[model samples]
Target: MPTLTALSPEILAKYQPVIGLEVHVQLLTESKAFCGCVNKYGGEPNTHTCPTCLGLPGALPVLNRKAVEFAVLAAKAIHCEIRETSIFARKNYFYPDNPKGYQISQFDKPIAEGGWLEVPTAEGGTKRIGVTRLHMEEDAGKSVHDGFMDSVNRTYIDLNRCGTPLVEIVSEPDLRTADEVFEYLTKLKEILLYTGVSDCNMEEGSLRCDANVSVMLKGAKEYGTKAEVKNVNSFRYIRSAVEYEIERQIGVIEDGGRVVQESRLWNQGEGRTYSMRSKEQAHDYRYFPEPDLPPLVVGAEWQAEILKDLPELPEARRARMEAEYGITPQDAMTFTATRAFADQFEAAAKKAKSPRRVAALLTSEITMRVRAAGIEMEASPVSMDGLVLAADLAESGELSSKMLKQLLDTAFANGEDFLAVYEREKPQQISDTGAIEAMIDEVIAANPKQVEQYKGGKKTVAAFFVGQVMKASKGQANPAVLNQLVAAKLDQA
Candidate 1:
């Protein structure tokens, strides 16, 4: 086992961290990858399994057509070049959950390879992370250890997840910091969700990650002994595990010790990684072709059909929004992060005559209201027309920015018509310049000393007079108009 320690300043200054990630995403298929069993989570133990999933003798496997189509669509969406023909190979292993004594997965010839995902960095820059390969595999069942004098003393297994279709996206060691990793994961999840490939519900174990972390000299070309952190299900854990592992490895090397190559598990509750087992090599899996299933040949026409069905990905949408709407890159990125959010934003923008105002409101006022209400953008009661109406009201001076925020909150909560709400609220406005003039005259007569101060070149006292006039008019006096009126009145006083 490797000893865990903190990195010294010397090591931190001299070395740069290298990181790669292997993400396992369970496909949203109706059935198992190779069997007709239900591919659902959280059910009675073993209730969703069939003879094939249970690996009974003489039982054969059949590939689910929808699963393959989804895999190809995912591959194309990520900019990967799909192999015209891909084969399935058996990876032999001994585990209670893997009843077949071997797992069907892609080895030498995977379904997709050589792709890239662009992630946004904290400094408002973008980094292109290279995808090494994307392959298909079946998930193993979960091992539950519970119900004992001590929970650690007893162990149980649930085979419901066995044979579930999964796509493993392998990335190169291009990430240098934890922030980069976070951005990459977020962007990847957005793409996956937009494509309808996976639900990406981390709480239900639908998506998981294994991080490969190591430390090398800052400008060196070679790598270091890397530790594979396994079973990290949440983004917070992924970040913490990588940071901790980087410090641990650097400390060991600085103290005249060598880091070992091994696999570890992240204890999210404790916020650390513990040794799980030694890292296995390719030979350890005993890779061979599965006799039950034949090779999969994706013809050109099939690939073309999947490509035609692919919608505009996040990058394309972001670029289009930036170009067409003249919004900032960051705002465009935010708007296009989700399909539904992007669609709603576009719909609202179309209804709004002022694109700049629409963009600003969506990113600021609307976003703040949505966050305060604890609801998603798509679920907000404020419709596209409602937003357009709010923008128009603000543009027409019917509402100030402050009043617009209040109006948006009311609209979101009650889903009432904005015009009707405005009429009912009827916020006082300084529409009558004559009324404002009378109020100004009253203030001038009441505050003769302030008027004298203004005439003596004490310009700051003019604001006080304006406030008095506004107070007399119940905050309905237009401050701008009152300012001009007060200046003119004081000039002759």
Candidate 2:
């Protein structure tokens, strides 16, 4: 086992790690890529298979129109140029899970090409990672090995996942570090979700990543032999794997051994990349045009139709949210992390008169509640309309800041909307001048020492009086009114 070490800055400055990620995103479509079988996850083994997906004797394949649309939408989401004509080829490989003996995928002609995903860097700027191509393919089924380790036993094959639509996004070798690769994946997943194309769930195998990593001497034009790391289900694990690979390759070169091009699996338990097999070149697969399917021709009209439905991507939406809601970049990024979050925030923010305050509350209070409850933003019990009402009540002196927070707490605790909880609680703010004056009077009488301190040039002690009055009124006291009342009462004392 290779022990993980912190590479010193001096060591890091001597070599460069060139990284690129090939991410496979399973499109969320109603049907499979080439068959009418349900494109879904988690069913009995081989239950979702069909003759076409199983490669029967005479079952011809037909392409799914929706899958193509989703591929185009995904490609456009990443700023890729849509190719007018693309070809589906047979990626020939032998695997028990592949019933067809080949995967229907695109080769020289892909669906889209030449796009870039801008990842936010730690230096408060963006680095654009080039996307080489985005192509469509069918996913293979999974092999469930049932026998114990080091024993001969039968292996079960589940074809439920076969023929599922997938869009493989290939990126240029522009990522220089594991952190860069992580940022690129994060931003790419966000864009994919925004377009409503892929769920990007790593656990269900809907989203997967294979990273090609190599280390070269600083300022060297020639590249090092790259190792492909797979079986990384999460972004963090992939980053760790890449970091370990870079270090291992550098160590090998240091010991006068050349790096080898190979495919490796990420040992998440051991935190290392172990070789699986020698990486195969393009010719090894012996690719050929998929005869059953015709050339996929996306015309101008089709492009217009698909482009019209493409949602506002992450970059443009982030900028618009910052400008429209008057929120800071951090707030904008948090609110627009996903399409659902952005939609919910925008809906509530637009309705509230104080958009900035609404943005703050959502990013702070609302997001915290949603995360703690383990519910998605769009599925929050507090609806956008309910949030708007809360914001309105807070801004118009109907509820104090503390009261507003209390109301949201009640809403979240009871798993009810703001209106529902507010109606039941009917919490009122003590904005009445005479009522507030009486409370302030009682507080001043109770805290005479603090009062005397305030009168003796301790102006800061006014906040003490405000807290007492707020406590007396059970936090429903209007903060602004209570503050004024406390200052006036202390000034007189």
Candidate 3:
């Protein structure tokens, strides 16, 4: 490709980029897809393999029923239409990690299809990203090429991951920008996590993405030549890779060069993509139905069983939380970051006297402290009831703002439960009317210049009186009532 300069926004706007993502999620099954080998990660190399997974002679593959259920649950979570019947096909490829010579995957018929996820757009609205298909397949093992003592270029094959079940979700070519793509992935992952179908841990290779990117003139009817970006694990890296590929393709076309259709690997260290090989078409795989496996059937009874206990999806759950808790849409979104977290919050809110105030405390203070300590909401040091108690104190004017901060900090530092700390030794907020009035009177007698400033129509000087009263009261006076009394007294002065 020829070198090209960066175009201005006006010039860049003349071209459009089309993007799509194919995500692979490893199911949380107890064993391999075709055999009884343990499906867990991080075992001795080749220890989790079996005759079926190793492609040995006289071995027959059997479908894992748990894998099917996971696939069905995931499909339903994405609002997909389940197929009545689907067949597995062989995807032929040569690699050290693939001992079976071909991967057993879905071809003409997949488990489900015709789903859509609504992703948030930059305009504060949402755009629908069409889900093409969700299909189940077997995973290949890993080839470890590093950690060789003698530098003779030897690679070690670990069959521990072979035959692990995976479901690949392919999306339509509907994405126009990297931001939209990021939003779509985030929502998709959120749905997947909500369903508990997969762990979606990119660090462990349980979740991965392949991005298809193309660029064309803004008004062009046909798309530009597309490239497949393979093996990007992180969402941020996926966004960055798609963006770089789009601009590179546009640059190539503008500089009188042809963009080739190929497979590229994202180099995270260098922040660029390099060609790996030519992108293969379906015919190149020469796919055919698996000989050992029969066409899988999904009947109405099975569908009903799966749907009967299906959990409410993210959007629906978020709406319900908003309606029931009387929280804003944004607060609902924060609370619904995870299903368990939302459930915990709702349970706590139900017991609180001031539910809205409890929600506020959770979203603002509790969530922040939990995240700052590198822990999840479920793992926080504070109990839900304890948090509610603290919120109740604040809402009822029994705990001042400074007291709440000190409570949270002390609770966090000591790894003490908030309620235990509150019940043991809480702040003595001075809510007594006469007591506060006496303190205010003493402050007024001490600060004559501030009182004069207040009487001279500089009404903002009432803040000075409140501060003096707060100081005189040793930070125990209710700030809200003090402000009110100070304002009323200054009006009289």
lDDT of 3: 0.88
TM-score of 2: 0.91
How many steric overlaps are in each model, in order?
Answer: 0, 0, 0
For candidate 2, lDDT tens digit of each residue in 358-469?
A: 8777778888999998988777888888888887888799898888888899888988999899999888888899998998888888888998888789899898888888
Mind giving the per-residue lDDT tens digits that candidate 3 earns over 1-493? Answer: 5343456667578899999889999999999999999989897789888899999999999999989989999998888999989999999988889998999999999999999998888898988999999999999999888656776887889999999999999999999999988998899889888888788899899999999999999889999999999978899999999988988898888778888999999999988899999855533778999999999999999989877757887799889878887899999888888878888888988999877989888888888898899997778888888889998899889998888888898898889999888878777999888898888888888888988888888988888788788877777899988888878777775
- Model 3: per-residue Cα lDDT at residue 464: 78
Query: After best superposition, candidate 2 residue 488: deviation in angstroms?
Result: 4.0
List runs of model 2 lying over 4 Å from the truth. Answer: 1-9, 280-283, 367-380, 438-452, 471-477, 489-493
- Where model 1 places Cα greater than 4 Å from the true spot, the runs are 1-6, 120-126, 147-152, 217-222, 280-283, 363-381, 401-420, 423-439, 442-446, 460-462, 465-493
Write down the RMSD of all candidates, one decimal each. Answer: 3.4, 2.7, 2.5
Q: Candidate 3: where is the Cα deviation over 4 Å?
A: 7-11, 147-151, 280-283, 367-379, 487-493
Candidate 1 local Cα displacement, residue 73, angstroms:
2.9
lDDT (C-alpha, whole model) for all candidates: 0.84, 0.89, 0.88
Q: Best candidate per TM-score, number?
A: 3
TM-score of each candidate structure, all chains considered together: 0.86, 0.91, 0.92
